[model samples]
Target: MDAKTLERLLNQIAAEHLHIDTLATRNSDRLDFHEVSVWGLKEALQAAFTAGQQSKQTTQPN
Candidate 1:
């Protein structure tokens, strides 16, 4: 995927699964830092993986 599409996908996943306001991570060290449980991290990773799989499927020629 392109940069804009990837950025949107990551933001969507973070909002849905990590409760993060944004993935910019450029505000400040403290503001960018987050405290999350292992379960939440796993959920976010799974969501990202699922999105990747779906994107790959759609972009591939049959």
Candidate 2:
């Protein structure tokens, strides 16, 4: 998908799995940083991958 759509999807995944407001880091500071467990990271990655796969399936022509 396009950049905007991808960003939204990533943000959604982060919010759902990591309890993050958004993945867009606005500044180089503690507030912008997060401490996430390996499991949480894995879950978010899996969600993103699933979203991409679903997007591809819908977009590809038969």
Candidate 3:
């Protein structure tokens, strides 16, 4: 996909991650499960963001 499309997807993922994190924080009873999920999501987000950044850098003109 093009850089713009990739960037937009990443933004959506980030927004969803934030929403999930907020829900996790609000539900204290299932905190452990939610926290684990949030951690996994965070890792995935970081990896995606890193890949997107690398793609953008390589595609840009010097």
Candidate 4:
């Protein structure tokens, strides 16, 4: 992937992670990022990474 696209993906991942962090912070019992499961934060990130990979693969060569 190009530098710009890679940077955007990284930023998106960071924002999603921060969203999970915000959710945990809103509650009394804090949940760890590792403690998540299917359909959770990690799953969301995994899907994003997969889609990003697919997009990169399918993108036209410069």
lDDT of 2 by residue, 1-62 (tens): 89999889888889989988977778977768999889999999899889989999999999
Q: Estimate each model's TM-score.
A: 0.86, 0.85, 0.43, 0.41
Question: What lDDT does the true structure give each of the candidates?
Answer: 0.89, 0.89, 0.62, 0.60
lDDT of 3 by residue, 1-62 (tens): 77677667665665565433332244456642434476768776786878778878988999
Candidate 4 lDDT for residue 15 = 56
lDDT of 4 by residue, 1-62 (tens): 78777767665664565444332244344454445445556756786779677887888686
Please give the lDDT score at residue 25 for candidate 3. 42
TM-score: which candidate is best?
1
How well does candidate 2 match the true structure in TM-score terms? 0.85
Model 1 CA RMSD to the hidden true structure, in angstroms:
1.3
Q: What is the lDDT of residue 54 in candidate 4?
A: 89
Error of 1 at 39 (Å): 1.0
Scanning candidate 4 in windows of ten residues, the lowest lDDT window is 18-27
Clashing pairs in 2: none
Q: RMSD to the native, candidate 2?
A: 1.3
Q: Backbone collision count in every prediction? A: 0, 0, 0, 0
Off by over 4 Å in 1: none
RMSD of 3: 7.2
